[model samples]
Target: MDSHRIIREAEGEVWVSCKIPGKPTIRGSLTSKGISSDEVPEVTASEEFVVQEVTKNRITVSCPEENISCTFLSPYASFSHIHEKNVSYLDISSGGDLGVSSSTDQTFKVWETHNTEVKSVLEGHTRDVFSCKFFPSGQEVLSGGLDSLVKVWSVNDGSCLATMKGHRGSILDIAVVADGQNVISSGQDGTARLWDSAQGACIAVVDDSYSPINAIAVAEVGNAVNLGSPKETPSNREVGTEGKLVVLAREDKSLEGVSLHSRQSVFDFDGSDAFNCCTFISSVGVLAGGLDGNIIHVDIRNPKSAVETVSWSETPVLSLVPFRDTYVASYGNGTCYIPLKGSEQVLQLTGPNRQPVFQVAAWKKLVYTCCRDGFIRKYEIPDLG
Candidate 1:
């Protein structure tokens, strides 16, 4: 099989694409035993009732701190070393190159796992590039920072392509919204700005909050599932792109988060500030994590709004990230990893090294956490466990 070819499952059946001419396809049942990240036993199954085949390979999964080892195999390359300077965010490009924006070094590094070397350093963001990502086509780079500027650069030459302004305060987060044509930016400025990605211009300002918007995700609405184009824009419309952003506007000066849609705070008050560090479950329309270390599932489609809420902390919570439908919340005291519909047993990871976690990003079963102690630890996740 050609390692580069796609071999992932699509429907009920397992899939394998053998790029090599003489190679045989690997096939099996998709039943993997589950366990917690700390090596605790767990029941493993696909909650959706669709059982695909799981394949085996040469790689072994290990967690030194937990003293756990398991046989695991995958088609893609695995990142083995822990990142330096507490990785605040880890983004993967289409080519699988990693963009690790950090606070420890106060710089963004581009890494290639094949060479195990940093290919380039995105050195423009003066402060931490809190949110950095490649465009959908992976031709350009976009980053926001405490510097209050959103910079776009060419992926090939690494030269500045365009700089979008208007963020009065530190830009905490950003998203390539409106189907890659527009960029949605949120910051301490208490407003979410919609910017023209190609023109590097601010189109509209969604000023629904007096508090900092920690995160914003744009989702296409019905009929307007597409965005405003330059040539196709209406004469009466002020902005070109018009898509709904699922923004988590944290209340003034704290973790109090509000779920926003269509430039309005529709769902509010779940915690001291759950919306501040919360993340929306993809395809599920649930907002997870807020104040009181709890995650609130707000169904935007529902009238009552409050669908479900889960408390993972007593201490002031910092962030909540979704690993599939399940989520992990980082607080001052500990980190709680939970699955929604299946496992009730909360996987708690706490230690001397586990300082207050500020932000977290997970890939596959690997987690990258940024802490106040200025250290980042990578741990293997128990997907089924």
Candidate 2:
């Protein structure tokens, strides 16, 4: 008879031990940098068991004699009671210390990321707040809601600094431009608008897609791409508006890129299904998640077709966020995955229990996810070796 045990020796290393009655114990270890021997034997002479793979989220092991293979999911820290109803969205501050979350309960909260303690309640929205983000300065927040209004709030005191109203329908997503001087928002009104954050004025209607814009991402485009100059003199208040592109995920199953300065369409790629979220992975790369769970990666330089499309499930992808060399994606099936770039390995964040994960945010190596189950989960990814 034989016995075996597996243990996590440290953040990125796993140790396994196997023993047979009246025989010396066999030990081995696996690490992100591959097998190691300083802490434990790289592999025992018996080779009864082996550590097959190691990742930030889980480890896999196999034993031939036992004819068994098993996977162990890493543990995570969770902040419960963050919301009363479904948590619609969450964003971590640039400083990585604070976070803001909006819920279907018609409430938004600024909280301490260390412990998820409520810092302040932002209470101006008359309807469900659908989207929220921390400004680059991390001292304020911008939010859009079902009330068809965009509000900026002071993080220090939770005061509504300004309310910008223009959309005839609910605001679905929001993006803050450089330095927080200006912001952009998309809505059910089928329009994307750029607003002067301080004055609560709409600088321009960036795009009128004639279909609901479900999500948007703003980033500086490559220098070679021509962003036509503004027809009229640009507003002096529009900081970081030039050379930037806004990617719109439309309900009409199209992903379009519009130049911020000229409000001209850069490219429009037809998608297989309605896109629910989008994000910029690089200066020239964009990723959009569709309702059918397809994650389409497109090169803005040549947006005639997608560079790659991957789908893990038929469930709708609710959120897409670039993290390190990879991106984290959340689905309506309560699953979240971190697909490592240039690798076949994918890390899954466990705990949602089939409850739809509405959003995923990353800061440094920490990943935060909000779910319909009213819990905010924080995953501290071990430093990759």
Candidate 3:
């Protein structure tokens, strides 16, 4: 045989084909020992075979002529009826026991991680809730809504604890500073604001980009990059805001970095298209997703250009989150991809049938995604640390 091919059709079926020197192409379903060509005399190229083993690291296929193995990732579980409309965003708690989701149905929900049972229904937003996240303590949720308001809710009782208002337009995304004392929010008003979670007051307008901010991520970038000093004395309420970098994804096709303490622009990189989402993969490395499906990886130390650009599809990239050494990205096509950090191998999670997966979150070995199909799918990856 000169060449052979193996393709996974579904959960347990793998298709295999090989070209022989003289005779018709040999095709068969994989058996315990090898491909049983005799048992499947009329096997077509599209027919699926049985794979020997499928795991997080590798997939092994045994054949009489040769053996084939490769890495594969797939979904293992799914949860339905979590919302009535498209689930716009979701975040898993640091404890990995709870999850919170926001949807177009003008509602927010907190659920159990194991079975996705509804724990509490967060109410108060007159419009759609666009973003929601759990605080580090896992006792509260911070949410931004189309009503141009940011609110904090108690996880134990589902009661609205605080309602923060300042932006003139819709609140698009949010980020919590170190601990749970302060939080940052981006809005359609073209500004990012730092707010005291306990007092419900805006500490300062961190940056007014003049372009609608779609998403924001905060991280302690350390002293490697110049964060600039504050022009005025920071308010005493600004807790744990020092040396933090806030990255903004804007509608003007710009990815900008700002100092949380100094409120200074650190760096800016123009993107191929309007940015929709962004996240910090490391202290100094950031990933920004664009409307044109480009995921630009940038190093703050040298922000003149992207370190690398990758695209999984032409569909818009909606959400991004760091998962172990790799990152997870969702798209408008209802697909999620896990691109390994240093390899060409890409794992796919499919279930919503191209209905637009809006957000994805990871906790330990489990991955949870919310889609336009009104379902929250949970995948348990094997051997995932």
- lDDT for each of the candidates? 0.54, 0.82, 0.80
Clashes of 3: 1
183-273, model 1: which lDDT tens digit per residue? Answer: 7788887877767777788776755467788776555443322222334333232332344435454655233222222343443443434
lDDT of 3 by residue, 128-243 (tens): 99999999999999999889999999999999999899999999999989998999999998999999999899999999968999999999998969999999999999999998
Candidate 1 local lDDT, residue 133: 71
Q: Which candidate is the best by TM-score?
A: 3
Can you write out model 2's per-residue Cα lDDT over 39-153, one digit (the tens) per residue? Answer: 5323222355666765445555665564444444443677668788888899999999999999988779999987778999999999999999999999999999999999999
Return the clash pairs for model 3, or none. 14-49
Which structure among the candidates has the greatest lDDT? 2
Q: How accurate is candidate 3 locally (lDDT)?
A: 0.80
Question: Candidate 3, residue 223: CA error in Å?
Answer: 0.5
Error of 3 at 360 (Å): 0.7
Give the TM-score comparing model 1 with the true structure, all chains together.
Answer: 0.66
**How does each model score on TM-score?**
0.66, 0.83, 0.84
